[model samples]
Target: MPSCLTCIARKVKCDAPDSLSDCGNCRRLGEECRRHNPVPMVVSRQESKQFTRAGTKRRRSQISCLDCRKHKRKCNGELPCARCIRMKRECEYDTSHGKEGTFHHSYSVQAPVLSSIQTSPSQTSHTSSSAAGYQSGSVNSPYFQSDTSTQDLDPLAMFAKQCPLFPEKELMKSLVQQFFARIAPCRLFGFLHEPTFMMKIDQGYGGRFDEFLLLAAICAAATKVNHEANKQMWESGVEWARYVLQQLILDLNRISVTKLMTLVVLHEHEYRIGNQSSCFLITGLCTRYTHILQLNVEYDNDILCQNSSLTASEKESRRRLMWCCYVMDSFASSGVTHLQLIQENKIEIQLPMSDEHFLFERAIVTDLTPDTIDHRAYLVRLMSIRNRILNYVKRFDKDRDLWDPQSEYHSLLSSLQEWCNIIPENWNLNHTTIYARKSQGLLSPLIELWIFFHLCYLDLYRVVVPGLSPAMRPEIDAVQIAAPTDFLQSSQEACFNHAVKLTRLLEASIQHEKDGPLDDPNIIIGAHEAIRALVSYAKVASSRINDDTKQLLAELVDISVHHLRLTQKRIPTAILGLRRTVSIIKNSGLAYLNYTNLESDSDSDSSQERPGLEEQLNPLSQFSVAARGLSERHGKGTSSARVGSECSSSQKSMFDDDNLLSPGRDMFPTSLEGWLTSNQFGDFI
Candidate 1:
């Protein structure tokens, strides 16, 4: 008796009385019982040897078909095996040894062009020796060797095989060139070295999944530039690149410098599409990778001691990547203290060198504190200052250092002033400076740096002006400590001035779109903020101001609105800003009814009723008596120390009264959570 095939396959006991009967296991499973004859154990030596040889030959003749071998299934030694016939797969077999007849299909396989550069035995031995020498101190030795072996496998072939939807090689080369020409010069893509990356593309991608992902990301970013002639090409490129990158991310199992660059590029893409939640999560992942790679510190330091094979350009690229991560975190957090991850004190890497030095692979030692003002380095420094300003504003409710000379507020204001005072003549926004930077491929980043400087000022001063700072509106209205009227007026004035400045810069950037590409979509955020401040001020003061001032404000608002509309075609988030601006203007109850039409109507009767309109629209008019009383109370104090403590209780009661009747509550949010959940900017998550 022998075990039935079903029981054998299931690895269960047959439990049958004899070979003629059905096995209990097969009966329970409701399958047919089939068995093979058992070998006799009492055979002579010659017969046993003959039986063993025949069994060996039978097993050799029953080689599994290719499809069955792939899925680890048993084959029944037929031309088209049972599993293959049942599953309708092509039955093929390896016949290199001339045992099987032949493969069912014949195909010509050509070796890749890069396979000619395969390392010889001597070269391989030398590489192994070099890798061994650095294994004692270098943490990246294994990665370096892995990259070398991957290069030997011909990356271009691997990429083509894995991603069948990739564009042809020539078109891909054009896209790569376009990326470097337009998008790489921006601060977000600064981590990619053009010469090094282009060389890798010309040769091969080293069969590294991360590098393939990086190529897809670059193509995706390049397609975002507005080009009418290649509109179809751009759309297809974006779609294909996005699909390939998503697949690569799912298959990703390790991290490297190229992978980090890929994630940075993807973050920018996500932001452009108004997917801020994805951008936030990606930022967190990038921060973790930065810590894992120890990118915050110099690679050559004792802790890392990178291998000698790492080039100067490679090290500089990693440094630029570290700074880019910090910048991404800063922008994504957008002044929220809890969301921020990168701390300024923990960053020990040096600032990036100038574009010239980086492009030519020049190894220059730029200290942590740069002496010369490189635009990229200056941008990092400004973001560091911005983080401080945002944190200070976030804690404004409980901060007791108002009007103190040594307060963090004063220090941040002084930093902004100093930044403006030290501006280099070369960095001016004239035609000559713009063209010069454009020729050198530095225009976009320089313009972004300039825009961020004004934005920083807006963020710091907009809190005092009602309906300007959405996140801090509740704190502004609920805080008990009464700020000086002079200080308050000055802050409001500063907000208006900076808003105008930022609007003008945005207009210039849009005007110069033909001179060079300015594809950074976050500039729209600046435009939206500028629009809020300008619109708020115009609603309150347009009636009281002279005709010339009124016309100027009208022109600025029109320009800002126009820019926001233009951005909406490329960035989906800009539509939110445009809608909010329209609602604000409509609710103000002024005669400037048409959003598209900003001109005043000469025959409208609203002009005759202008005298009392100011009182109705002014947010601060009802609080005038309380403000004056607080001023008098402070004036009666003999010592400066007594002013803050003595006015606390009275100021609290006054603010409480104002909060109840505040007219700006409709114009602005009353709480942070309410603002985020409101329809205006609620889609951020």
Candidate 2:
């Protein structure tokens, strides 16, 4: 039953009983008594067949386009398929199957066939048998056979065979857990999202070669934090991981984020092992890969829409990886422009989010480097500032004046102060704050962050303090101000204060090592720089400062040296650098009191024999004994006469060379400046 259109339009109820019947009101008015009867949809035979085929599922084409087949995408069975045209790839179909009367396409035998495709009964039976074999993990299955043929060729497989740890799933899992727990929290290694990475590990790395490589690298890094009992086992695993990663570098035909992550970890591992040259080369490789991948720029929303495979977490990881590369570049370049591969102006990617957001895979938008105070983002920002400082310091010869208010030096100094002002109060290094951060597993990163901040001040202010920075000594000497100006005095005072602060911070960090050892190699460099600044100031200010001030400076140097000795056990480069610094202090005739012995002696009231002040002030007279000791240890000639002759000649020509820090020279230099500007110190940095 339905209402007529005329009656309904007139706002009256219809009396029609069916859709085809006329209404009573229209019939009485002698108007057309029409009802709203929807006409039946008619179809031609061809159109009916098309409709039937659409509902039942039309058969797939007997062939696929070449481009579609290569990329494993769907084809529309047209001359040029939609995928091919959209991807801008050439499209061509194989017509040879048409002549065989049995249509066929070249596909992997493991690929499932569409149910609508027509196949011979024998083919159907063979496919069923193959499916059963595949399900059972039989070697006879084509997919399994193909995997077997290339199993030995895979680098990860070779690595697994070589790595004893990889075969022990439990041990491997322990090391992986150790890495994420200890090492991955550092800002440089924060690119990895633990939940996603752990999920992949629980699924056996999802059969990905890159994931396996990253896992191997993780195991190697974790070994750095391992105990001494397993040192040999850890070393073997590290060596195999390094070798396999080196080999994999040669086979990289495409760029991937996982591969970049592996290289980043391996770069840090290289630095930890004292291979600065390898670290430099690897950083360059990573920078090139980063550029090729365009990780420096955020993906356009349109591009992100087209690539459905990129998840929100993956996008965040890309941004983090980009920042990691920037950090590595900053360290490797160390302010040398020719070595700088990634420029800040070129970086358009957003800074990393907070660890909470990143680890939980939240897709929140974050501020850029200058705005964000998130731990990871702020670390990158500080790194950018440090890079600018280094570049300005390195190019001191070109700068007009360090004291000018409008100069680059003042600009960099202002930036450093601004950075310090923005630091949250909780970041302060005290016993209570240290313990609080330790409870949250953030003690190491907090210490490292402040260490880096102090290092920037050391590099900047040391340029004006004569004998402190070897690189700037000649340039500063050329200016030759007779009496120190207010600016120069302020710079010297700033340099000395920061050096003392750096030493104290390091001492505090070492005393509070209940959580773990400081893993960052840069900590060692910071300690060395602090010691250098303190010793240099002691030498120049010996006549001006009182005995108590001299003793205080000596204690600071001892504290820094103690830290170096402790770090030497973990980092090989630290051992050599520490020895050199010790030799320099002894030869320079600066007070080399042992801080721990001083404490014990004060309690026992036992007097320790100390070198006389006259001998300490005479730097040239004290060089022979220290030089001979170093020479004898290195298997060089131990004759005091030869050592004296070399010391005399070194003092005469120490400032003659332009590139004082050049490599491949004497392992033990005679003068304090020689030791400060030696290749050993340069390579350690």
Candidate 3:
């Protein structure tokens, strides 16, 4: 019997089974067990031809690539074979060179394969055989080690090691359900489809990395329900989110709607954690990526009208994502008028439809134009109004060539009033039924919409607000040299009245939140801004106002302050900023009264530089300076500066005889009259 090539090469005894084509040794080793003919002499061309005709046909080359050979594994004998592709390594076959059994030197660049020819076991050393996949010291590589391979580098496996048991298929499903039920009901989070999202999650770890990132984000958002049971889930969700982010960076560069939505989720998470700066940065990325994906553009129905074209779901998804992006970009960059990211006019996409229509991707709700709109449409309208308001405010900036407040103020006010007049019956602020709906969660979106509307309303007219504009900070060189003032009594009264309505709404919202889920950071911060505005108005107008007006402002301030102090723990950063501004105003108010009294009384030193009426009445002037210093101090680090940092010992000492609201102390003013007076005073004391 002819011995197999491998047995002959090793000089081992041939062991065969009569029933099997392959020899016993070769079969057991999973090697290509072909028989070899004995060497024959070639006397002449005619004799050689006769000998070749008589010889049996040898089997085709069945040898594996160099990598498989080194690992003692099976390989399909193709150039750049399956194993090479999976391992992400170069594949090379052995080629004949100058002599028999000699390989081309260049073949070593990729791990060179061994020739299929026979060789003695003594001649082929184990070191040389094993070195097929390596150079000197290459064994130190993790890939070269037996335990670690390309599979070990999988992000899912790495993520599994970090976040075990969480997002374990069933748990992830439940969390996703919770997200849709709780958070997704909000218009801002309506970007993803329930069925599609669930189907992707069903793909498990084998699914797209972007899908996993989205699921992780959903998990994080769902866990925001503020229950003790959800604490572990929140932490696990955060871990998984981090894992997804790490994996996303390593994965393909394809930017999909899923990635944009994931970023939005992460942005909200940052905002929830009071990381406004991070939120702004992430929103910018989301906006840029959204624009790149052309989600901001309307679906080309002319091209996509065919059967295989973009489906209703796809179009709706694009619209939803685009709208959400617009909302977030507008929301995050709302206060900083010049920093807005999305250009509203550049977007030509349709606003998202009703949740029912969008969710099922059905055309059942064909009456797109309506006198009264749904919550989603109402929100889009509000965003439009907000966009207009922001644009109007942008014109007030001194750097803008269009800085003409007198020309624009009436038109802007008219537009805002038109918006208020056109509010749908369902969204009417005065309707008790609407309040009932809000309590029942039927009008949940309106709660935020109202707050956002008021926030924008406040921002629009704040430039002309009486106490803060021309009369407030006239002494500061920057204030004087900065934007030109356009103080109007109508803008002033309108601003204060809006502040009153907003503060009332905020107080009610906070009180309502006592039994509901935790307030979002937006609501908290919006409320904080309202409080700051109210207190500033009161602080500036207190000395020149009547006792009744003083009491009214005082009540508003107290309620806002009470709600703020109650919810400060959940949103310490936001609460802390407002607290600092309030503390500064209070301290500065006290300083103003003391300085005035010092100048008036006979016991005072004549040489002392008494503060003028501007400083005495408008303590915000000093507060602004100290606040700038505080921002400079805190801007250097990630950790929060104390609320008292807004008013330093040096700042407070300028007003009060002592450090009234230092880090460890509460901001309780000793005298309401000293800190915040109600009675009107003449130009002279």
**Residue 434 deviation, candidate 3, in Å?**
4.1
List the candidate 1 regions with Cα displacement exceeding 4 Å: 1-154, 204-206, 227-231, 302-309, 367-373, 472-474, 478-481, 516-518, 540-544, 590-685
lDDT of 2: 0.60
Order of the predicted models by lDDT, top scorer first: 2, 1, 3
| Candidate 3 per-residue lDDT over residues 615-635, each given as its tens digit | 121121222222322343322
Off by over 4 Å in 3: 1-165, 195-206, 227-231, 302-308, 335-338, 364-373, 394-406, 430-442, 466-487, 514-518, 569-573, 588-685
Off by over 4 Å in 2: 1-159, 162-167, 226-229, 302-309, 368-373, 480-484, 592-685
Ordered list by TM-score, greatest first:
2, 1, 3
State the number of backbone clashes in model 2. Answer: 0
> Which of the two, 1 or 3, has more TM-score?
1
Candidate 3 clashes between residue pairs 3 or more apart in a chain or in different chains: 591-655
- Residue pairs that clash (backbone atoms under 3 angstroms), model 1: none
lDDT of 3 at 509: 61
